[model samples]
Target chain A: MTVFRTLAIAGLLLGYAAVTSAQSAVDEIAKYRQQLQDGNPADLWEARGEDVWKQKRGPKGVSLERCDLGLGPGVVTGAYAQLPRYFSDADRVMDLETRLVHCMVTLQGMSLADATKRPFGSGTNRSDFEALAAWITAESRGTKMNVSISHPKEAQAYRLGEKMFYFRGGPHDFACATCHGESGKRIRLQDLPNLTEKAGAQLGYTTWPAYRVSQGELRTFQWRLYDCFRQQRFPELKFTSEASIALTTFLAYNANGAAFNAPAIKR
Target chain B: MTQPRPLLLVLLFVLGGCATPTELDIAKQAHEVMRASFKETGQATLDRLNQDLAQSACSIPPSTSVNKEIAATIEKENMASIRYPADGKLLGDWKSGERIAQSGVGKQFSDDPKNASGGNCYACHQMSKQEISFGTIGPSLLGFGKLRGNSEAIQRYTYGKIWNAQAYSACSNMPRFGHNGILTEAQIKDLTALLLDPASPVNQ
Candidate 1:
């Protein structure tokens, strides 16, 4: 562990040197990304999350051990790969974060407002959701995405998500398609994945709930949609809302058969 | 891109078997979903969900192109919407224009509504050679004045194009900066100068 820590610090210094060595912007960014992949800080969040899941601390004074994440109760193993699935209890399609929130409310006896108050973490005030998401997604690493769309509501969500992808409005008149619909397009240096197809969907959707280095936070898929809508010059996307679930369903189903690989690190 | 027809056929076949919704039905339902899902926050009101003819037409996939006659009509209508300055002065400080182009903040729910909006031109277009981070979504405007001298016709074309991009190129990815009130006539003049002024860094 000590040796790994030393190597990580040395890699950071080398990355900094590369950044200042008058390299091309793309080369510098690529080098920085390579360095980031060496030792992800997401491991830290996952560790914290495991403790949070087991600790009895909510109003009901119970751990989230009984949370049925579509793989039955208390089964964190490979549960994330099969979401945003229909839950008869919720009577709605829910992605991982939404299900987590549901469990916090139902199993922990926490108020809805209190449970959702800090969905996204700030400095030193980490979100339970982010940490929990980090741990949950990490458990599903290497599992194939198998999001089921057999239910009528699940299929409806998929169709709605498809339409929403192409829906253009607002002052900029931008849609998800504006940035992500086309192949081989980008915004500045960042490549825009065409989420309409399988390959792009696999690359884009299967690797979220990422540890964002720039933001210094474990960003969930809900956070991803929220931030994207902000850049698209649209109104704020509500966390765990139906629209978010639908969009996640579309992307997840498209990424079916790809290996789940998060909580991944991102710049 | 040629995959849309097969995809559509598959969708239709599946829907036919399952009593699934049509494209128009899905579109309407999507709008309803947006209406139910989003709330009015800061500068972004729920009314923003409403799409104009140009927006709806331009929202189609790459496999689908607008009809030529409809495209021409869109151009003509957008051309009619360009409001030139009353003084007929089409130029302003290119330095200010540079700042406006650099700023990508505005119209977001988190942004201050009272703050002046920027054109955010560099988000899509390459304006000056020095700004290596400019996006390639739009055509490069480097050496605009050097390549096309600032003739009266050229100045008018540049100003009009910036005012309402759809006027020049129907269903353009470029926003209608002036027509949408994103930038004022004065700010548009400044952007016009940014492209048309030989003294500007964009030309240099």
Candidate 2:
């Protein structure tokens, strides 16, 4: 009887120690992260990005300062968090960068083809766009994401985006859902966020225009989408295509209440 | 039959020596073949074929368990390579970061050589709720700031992980951004804000 009692006590002690150790391990990781946060490297991009925003260029020799970001003409503050909204002039929902392109072409007299064809952050045109997008997004740093889908077009785009997200047809027989639709999934060591959830939506949607340490260059949202198709072995998604816009609307709507953040850094 | 015993033994020995290829050997061969088959084109050059230690390690078959000692060594080596910003700032313009992450241009065979590279983060991560088109290789970073809070430590982790994912995870498939020079420091800062800033869409 004594031997059995002693065995039970030992088992209980082992279980307690195991649980405590697991919790402590998690805490240790968190603490380690904290220690490293004193200096972040992303400030350099932000500074240059701001400079690029105000510089004047293009055929008309005008800057994007006078451009309207839907809030008002020449107003850039707090515009990013409320993007993919309805635009009466364009008669469609427009995100920040696309709308900027329209402004640069129309207001600044820059050719549409020149503006669109320039690769991201390549020539003066693309650089201007990146800087403008960066500065404007920074202005709305604390704002919540509120993409309006009140318009019929907005609703249609959202639905289309949803369909696209789930549509599966590629060489690998992969769909976005195959990787992101589930919770607690990971590729190697990277954690896979569940896009269907609120927290996941916020985490997934708001961080972009990020720096890629691997490529040694800044990237835009359009490029990000295009790469997804590439990895999926699917046909490329044209820059700022209807499919792209619709998908943006869907994600924005899903992240209605989440805060906005962009131009982030990544490995 | 007794006289043939030696011959039977020799036949058994020969049969035993013919073993199947080990998983590691098979992986190595496949990697070598893949490296040899591709040629450089435009910005996408043959140099991209080279695999870092992390990639090479991951190419091997996954057994029931990973040797903890090797994993630790990989992580330590990668961690030692992480470079923090010269100045002490992690946050940047979320707007610009958004564009960078969204773009999938540059570094392709057909791409213009003059153009700058893009992060293509959306291809692997869901960043903003407003942007619907994104990939799923990595996790959704939306509300990252909100959940974890924009503490200094979280910012550091974000920067370090993005700079060299292998530092955090020995065999992570995620690319080493800083180690490979894939993005500039400014771009990294902007992306950091996108993930950790309270006002950014990710935190929303």
Tens-digit lDDT track of model 2 for B63-128: 112245556766898899888998999888988877888776654556675876677787767777
User: What residue runs in model 1 are displaced by over 4 Å at the alpha carbon?
Assistant: A1-23, B1-21
Q: Looking at model 1 chain A, report the run of 10 residues with the lowest lDDT sum.
A: A14-23
Top model number, TM-score = 1
| Clash count in backbone of candidate 1 | 0
lDDT of 2 by residue, A116-169 (tens): 765465423345555556667777777888888888877766766665565433
Q: What is the interface RMSD of each candidate, in Å?
A: 3.8, 14.8
Instruction: Please state the CAPRI-style docking class of candidate 2.
Output: incorrect
Q: Give every collision pair in model 1.
A: none
Model number with the top DockQ? 1
